[model samples]
Target: MFGDVMGMMGKIKETQQKIEETKQRLDTVLIDEQSNDGLLKVTLTANRTIKNVSVDDSLLEDKEQLEDYLVLVLNKAIEKATAVSEAELSAVAKDGMPNIPGLDMFS
Candidate 1:
């Protein structure tokens, strides 16, 4: 029983390391989103860090419209990034988890 506990502890440590590595890798995963009218675009990392934002000059003429475009496009980019981050991290964690009976958290 102690041996099993030690093995499980080792597995948990490995999973933590993998999770950290996955987070570093996620920083390079980019997600791009654009406005419906193509006047605004955004790029973000899977870590949800904004990389860039491009806006057409036409959007500069209207403050409210530009704000709306920014909100919509940025939200879309964040959502996509969040999904990618979650999927990658979860896959790593689930793969590294020990097969403990009755603790089917991933399922």
Candidate 2:
């Protein structure tokens, strides 16, 4: 019926709006992570863009150690950022994705 088609069209429009809102929400999300001893730190966006990094002055004296710690700290920050992105995206998907049989399994 025409009424049923109209209702489905409205739902699609609403879902599109929700998707845009979720993208905006993701843009504002920032995740900050630091090394165990606080010698290195990094700030990353939920979209995996590195925003900032801070390293203790002492670490700068040793190039080898600094490289090691840089890798460690960067990896930690990336992991945290990925987790945040996944959680936020999953929440948005659960809210806006169309309902279909067996679709929950993929989620």
Worst 10 residues of 2 by lDDT: 97-106
lDDT of each: 0.95, 0.80
* Deviating ranges (above 4 Å) for candidate 2: 1-13, 105-107
TM-score of 1: 0.97
Model 1 over residues 1-107: C-alpha lDDT tens digits? 99999999999999999999999999999999999889999999999999999999999999999999999899999999999999999999899999999999986
Question: For residues 1-107, what per-residue lDDT tens digits would candidate 2 score against the true structure?
Answer: 68776776787688778767776776678888888899888888877788989999999999999999889888887888788877876776577655655757436
Per-model TM-score, in order, reads: 0.97, 0.77
lDDT of 2 at 52: 89
How does candidate 2 score on lDDT? 0.80
Give the best candidate by lDDT: 1
Cα misplacement distance, residue 12 of candidate 2 (Å): 4.3
Clashes of 1: 0
By TM-score, the best candidate is 1
